[model samples]
Target: MLSGLLMIVDMQNDFVTKNGSLYFPQAEKVKPVVIDIVKDRMKREYDLIFTKDWHDPNDLEFKRFPVHCIKETYGAEIFDDLKFIIRDYSKINFVMKKRFSAFYGTNFDDILKNLSPKHVEICGVDTNICVMYTVEELKNRDYDVVIYENGVASYDEKLHEFAISQMRDVLGAKIEKWRSFNAQH
Candidate 1:
């Protein structure tokens, strides 16, 4: 069993629900897939980490969008059943990242070092920004990044497609789909 961490990024209500500050159609579509990945990934005993975009309702970050994903609100909560699905009695490092990079302002790097992960599979919402940003961070540190394309959800199909391309072309990461990864990796 190779040491690996599944980075589930910003698949919360603020980005999934229609009323979200920056909702994307594909994100909602991929919600079930993300949950399934989390469930299955946990059974493998691999490190499961989620990067939440818990923003202040009136933060300047929302100036581009609006107030959403405030703490304890529906938007802030992980997508439905995502909570019930992953049985974590042991506070499994669910960090809240204020910026696009999960590495910033959080103990993400420290946690990964503890896990000592050799490979990272990043899946979540907002493809172009957070996903791309985090992938680059991991690459800079020479981590093998496996990006689950369908496992991630994004706003704007153009951005989503281009994001994947960017990872493959620029980052030298493996690009795979959810179904492909589900086929007994």
Candidate 2:
């Protein structure tokens, strides 16, 4: 049986690039960590997944957040640095999410049912929002979740730290440094 699943969440151009509508500077630093996690997961032969924030032009989420990552646009595409890597990897489950939680309006549950991974490891953007919400849902579903601390960041430093703590304490997800996973495998 496969021991783990690696989920790269919301690592889209809109969240990672400087000129994006909702650009956060910390996202640049987190990109390399996310890339490293992807490479490690590739070597480990675990089920790999990516969650994209594929919003519509009139998405209701635009009321609270800035309009970004519209479907079929460059902003909705994966960050350039990671795109080629994912492209080269043949087995990737791409989940297009309309909401903060990937499982809310997508085929994520079906994919999980098929893979049946022993644990899920997550890494991606907006530690306080999409990442946090997805982690919560995974925990609710009783999946053993491990979040890569160095691979997650948000626009607000306070909220990022708060979300990390909340996931660790309240959600019961394991929070570990990304380097440790590489060292182990």
Candidate 3:
């Protein structure tokens, strides 16, 4: 039985690619690592779940950050490289989120409940923001959350490290390098 879920958070063009409006410097570098993790997990008893920031044109979040990931726009789409691997949406679930945390204003909680995963591994961009919030929420829901250190990135290096530490120490999440985690699974 598939009791593990791999959550790829905000690996969309706006956060992970150069052409995006809110692209992070190290975001592109984590792509290959995230892809490798995905491929490896696909070969295991783990299901894939991708979360994208599908914001409304007039979303309130625009006041905090630059306008990006507007619905139906290229910025909101998943990176081209990752899109190819999603050959079947039925097997790979996609969750469109409007806020920083995937659990807010989305059916993410319901989906997580339905899947009933024993563990959830998270990977993606802006480690200090979206990824951090998601981790906090997942932990609050009592899920065993694992963060792939090498597969996630942040524009600010210090904040990235801090977020990882917070998730590991405060939220009680397991932090591991993608290669190390993949090797075990």
Question: Among these predicted structures, which one has the highest TM-score?
Answer: 2
**lDDT (0 to 1) per candidate:** 0.81, 0.91, 0.88
Better of 1 and 3 by lDDT: 3
lDDT value, candidate 3, whole model = 0.88
Q: Give candidate 1's whole-model lDDT.
A: 0.81
Clash pairs for candidate 1: none
Q: Mind giving the per-residue lDDT tens digits that candidate 3 earns over 64-173? A: 89999998999999899889876654557888988889988888888888888999999998899999999999999899999989999999999999999999999999
Q: Which residue segments of model 2 deviate by more than 4 Å? A: 180-185
Flag the better candidate by lDDT, 1 or 2: 2
Kindly list the per-residue Cα lDDT of model 2 for residues 1-185, writing each as its tens digit: 55689999999989898798898899988998998889888887878899999999999999998999999999999999899887878769999999999999799999999999999999999999999999999999999999989989999999999999999999999999878444766
TM-score of 3: 0.94
TM-score, each model? 0.90, 0.96, 0.94
Report the number of the highest-lDDT candidate: 2
CA lDDT for candidate 2: 0.91
Candidate 2: lDDT of 21?
A: 85
